[model samples]
Structures are given as structure tokens and as C-alpha cells.
Target: MKRWSRAAVVAVSAVAATALVLTGCSGSNKGAGGGSSSPANGDAASTVKQAADVMAKVTGMHVSLTVQGSVPNLAVTKLDGDVSNTPQTVATGTATLVVGKNPVDSKFVFVDGHLYSDVADPGKYADYGNGASIYDVSTLLDPNRGLAKLLSNLQNPKVVGSEQINGIPTTKISGTSSADDITTLAGARLSPKDAQNTPTTVWIASDGSYHLVKIEISPVQNGTVTMTMSDWGKQVTATKPA
Candidate 1:
């Protein structure tokens, strides 16, 4: 039997609400476990810079995403990754938002029109009504989600700490969040939390498009969650639906 996180299940269930697109990464990519980027690539010297450069190339593109709230309170993290600026690929012109997200878990989302997940049987999630597919959410993540702007606004995130994550050495950079750190996607404005209590830390990638290899978020009042990426597949030629 497969155990899907509640948030992941909801995201999978709601994927059909957005427009869909199909694209694939060029060149050969490895599976979850094949080889890994050398530890040298994860050096603090260039981790932040590398992520910035990669995100810059993919900025301003419309990307739809199905962000599942990992926390039990799904409502809080439901809209973790909302695409407002980007036009709806499947929903025509609807903005999908979810709240109540948790940290420390994998999620289900659209990957080039394909239902994919870090978990099992992800492909079966091709249904959510309204012609929405998993890839539809992928279209919302296009750098327009304020990722690059967040990174740029960061006061030089550094590798202040490190730990072994899935056998890979993960680094942490501590800093504060800001309203400007948030990016406006499609047409909506996403403002990062400005509370001093919510100290944010961005993980450093060893190599490739260092685009936020992972992120740790803590709430002001209480609670915390983390989002980690297990794959960095090639660019999928997905576009925002008109």
C-alpha cells in the first residue's frame, strides 16, 4: 500500500483545475539514485550565486504549480505556490490557491502534463476536472513566482550551517524575510512574511540551477515547514494558457 501525505493528495486531487502543458527535459537525466553532484559543487563560495544565475534565465515565465500543504492544517499552506500573473493554461483564467502546508515531505504536481510525484503511482493523478493536469501547476512555478526576486532581495544568503540530507550535504543560509522579497506572478502580488520572528533560511545546492535546492520556513506565531527538491529535470517547454 502507498501512503500519500494529506497535502500531496489534495494537490493531486486539484491538479485538473489549471491549464495543462507537455514538455520534457533535454539530454539524459538520471533517476532519483544514480550519481550525484560532487560535494565540491555545494561549496558555500558559489551556492547563492549559482542559484541566482539559473533562476535569472527562467524568470518572467508563467508557471502553474500545485503546492500541497504538508502540514495537517492544509488550509495554511494551501496556497504555498499560487500563480496569479501567469494566464490559466487549463482553468482559462482562474487563480488556484491553497493554504496549510507542512515541511519535510514530497508532493505531487504536474510535470509537463504528466502526473508525477516523489511518491509512487503518481501518473494516475491525470484527472482533476476542467482539463487541468499536473503540468498545469508546473507552468505557475516559472521564475515569476518571485523565486529570483526573493533570492536577489536576500542579504547574501550564506552557508551558515550544514547537514546530511538523503546522503547529500545540505547547507543553510539564515536571513529575514521582506515584502519586496516576494514576487508578483501573472498579476497577483506575493509578499513574503516580514515578521522578524520568521527567520528564513535557503538551502544551498551543490550544482546545476541552484534555484532554492531547498527551503525552510517558520511561522511568526508558531509552526515551521520545509520544501526540498529531489529533481532538477531539464526545461519543459510549457507555456501559460491564453
Candidate 2:
């Protein structure tokens, strides 16, 4: 299997998700939601407040999610599209993030709260690629993690703008990277292209739990990208291979 870089998967998901926003009735979080308040349209100041509020409720909490989203044009093809309503099941195990999508043709499971890529064994297990040490790749974009560094790909920087989602108003945020933000998001240094791969987008939510409802990423070199959260659940389990 070809290796899928974490940044490619996430940043694109960030963009493809935005398409989900377009499907709703006037971008309102009404028909489908976690019983939480509908997302709202607000400015950057309000967005940060919403993000902080929603993040406080569920951050670090393992939840079960029947997410029907897609990462189109992944690994190549510019990935300027999106997919929805697929049978994608996600289980955030108390210890790890486990995904199962028998029909979707893809599943990514994080082991014991860590994101490490193990190369296929050529008769024996060994490292691959540039041999860069892998950290908690799963937590890179998780709004709950407050580290010293943030990856250009994962950091949800200060709110930049705002837009309505699911019939609700929301705040837009730009996730830019500098020495500190990069360190806080990624725990290391990265080049500008790496930063470009990093996604910048708008966040939508009604209640405080800044549950990500919609996102759009546009990179100069790469095509457009987006991801949207269809539903949310809690205290779910993702069983992993022993």
C-alpha cells in the first residue's frame, strides 16, 4: 500500500468538509446534529469563543461517530472534490482512535493514542522514508491538545473570518504557522510548502462545543479541500488489532 502522509489526509479533509456545509438547508444545523445547538454565523472574535466553548465540553472525551464524509483526490489528482453519506464508522477508543468502513475502502486506526507509521516488514520490520520520528499524529488537529508547537497542517489559528453553516452563523479561523504556533501544533519546525499544505479554514458551530461542522482549505499549489462533520456521539469504543 502506498503511504498516505498525515498532512495530505487532514488538510484535504479540512477542505472537502466544506462541501458538506453546502448541502444543508441554508447552512443550518437543524435536521442532523448531536442535539447540540445549531451552528451560528459570527465573526472571528465570536468564532474563537465558540471554539473554546465547544472544545471544553468534549475535548479529550472518547466518542462514537457515524461520520459520512470523504477525502476526494487524495494522494494525488489535486483532490478538489468531496463525498458524503457513505457508511463511514469511527470509534474513538478510550486509548486510541479506531475507524472501520467495510464499504468505504479505507480505514485509519491510531494506536494507543499515538500516531506512528510502521513500514511493512521486508522479511523483518524496519523504518522507511526520511526516518523522521513520528509523534502523536492523531492529536495534531485535535482542538483539545495544547502543546508547545503546532503543525502548520493542524493548528487552528485565531479566528480569521466567519460564515453561516447548517442554517447557523459561525466564525472563520485561519490556521497559520510561525515558530510558536508550529511548535505548539506539531512540536517542530517545517518549511513553507509544508506550511502551505497546512489547512486554513472556517469553523462552524452553534453551542460552545465548537464541533467542527464545516471547513474549506485552498492551497496555492494544491487544489481546493474540505470536510464536514455530519453527526456526533460520545463514549464510543474503537477496537484495535492486538
Candidate 3:
């Protein structure tokens, strides 16, 4: 597998960092919400808000992401990792990138406010200044700017139905959000055309906790980005490379 350049990796990190922003919506919606375990009396907007609130307080979670199609500058096709937000935000994960039609894997760790990756120097970590600027996974837990905000800002939200995700019951909600809002949260630059209304879907745990389980976003006409989160509050440790 061919390793990508620093610039390319930076682009990949930006998108990978935004993987956790799956918790929120950005505008108002009108729809009847009724599900087996719907929150806020089966109101779609209310249910989404509750889930966003719950996600805001999460300290740690396991996240997985998959991207289909293209986004400017973003090269990562898949990422799986554990992220911690309390005390100090940190994350460690495996990232896969498609280079020249071939997939390459890399190991990454964020600790002490910097991103370290083996892509630049095979078998050794290379320092990438300012993890937050490069790939701030902590943003996923931000109440004001991350998932919470996204959920509250969702447009035309409606409770479509219910489904089981990873064996956990979840209520499904669908809506649209502006591309600009998503770009801000993800910290990735998107094409002007993508600034139009983007379709979004969220699945919140129906088990009363209202934790966010999955989110899907269509940023372009034929491209989709999906994120799944689990193991909320899990203990995660990221150590500086030796």
C-alpha cells in the first residue's frame, strides 16, 4: 500500500475528525413522531433533541465510519477508533485510505494535543502539529458546536420509523441540513454546490437513554458518509509514541 503525503493525511484527518458530529441536526422539522420507544412523546424534533443532549455529556465512545464517493481533499475511506473527550480529548484508531485504486492502512494516535501517524514515516510516528486543527475528534462531543447543535438545527425533521442497530432498539429520524453547517462542524471544506440542503438520518437509542447510535449524511449527489457509535463512556487511553 502506498502512503499518502502529509497534506493528503491532513485532509483525511479533517474528515475523520468530524465522524462524531453524527449526533446533531441544524433546523426545524414538522412531522408526527411515534415509535415503540420514542422520546418526548413521539415528537420527532423533541426526540432528536433529547438524544443530542445525552450525547453532549458523553466522555468516551467507540466510532466507526465509512465514506462512499468523493469529497474534496478528504482521502480516508474508512476509520474505526475510540475517542475520549473528558480531561483532554484523545483518540487512537486504524484508518484506511484508497490511493491509486488500492487501499492502504495506517495507525494513528492523538494525544497531548497533537496528531501522530505512521503514514509519513513507516513504523514510526510523525508529529502533526495541533491535533484539534488536524483532526479534533473531541468536537463530536461538543454540546454547542457538535452533535448537539446539529440535531437542534435539523430541518423538517420527522420520525420515519424504528429499527434495531447492533441489537439495540433505535428510533429512526430523517431530515435535511445545510451543507455549510455540516462543513463547519466537520472542519472540512466542501464545494459550493454542496452547500445546498443535504439529506441526513439519525438513529437514537429507544431504550430511554436516547444515546445516538448511527447517523448518515449525503453531502453530494452520489456520495454518502455514515458514522456509527457505541460503547459510550468506555475507558480509552492514548499514549505518546515511544
| Best candidate, lDDT | 3
Error of 2 at 69 (Å): 18
lDDT accuracy of residue 234 in candidate 3 = 82
- Measure candidate 3: CA RMSD: 23.7
Show model 3 residue runs off by greater than 4 Å: 1-41, 99-101, 131-135, 185-187
> Please, what are the lDDT tens digits per residue for candidate 3 over residues 134-192?
34566677777777778878898888888999999888999988776577555556787
TM-score of each: 0.43, 0.40, 0.78
Compared to the true structure, candidate 2 yields what TM-score? 0.40
lDDT of each: 0.42, 0.39, 0.77
In Å, residue 65's CA in model 1 sits off its true spot by 11
Off by over 4 Å in 1: 1-46, 58-140, 180-198, 207-211, 234-242
Per-residue CA lDDT of model 2 for 57-170, tens digit only, reads 432322222212332212211111121111222222111112243231222334344322222321232322221132223432344442112211345556555576666555
Residues 157-189, model 1: lDDT tens digits: 555766554555556777655533321221223
Ranking by TM-score: 3, 1, 2
Looking at model 1, residue 46 earns an lDDT score of 61
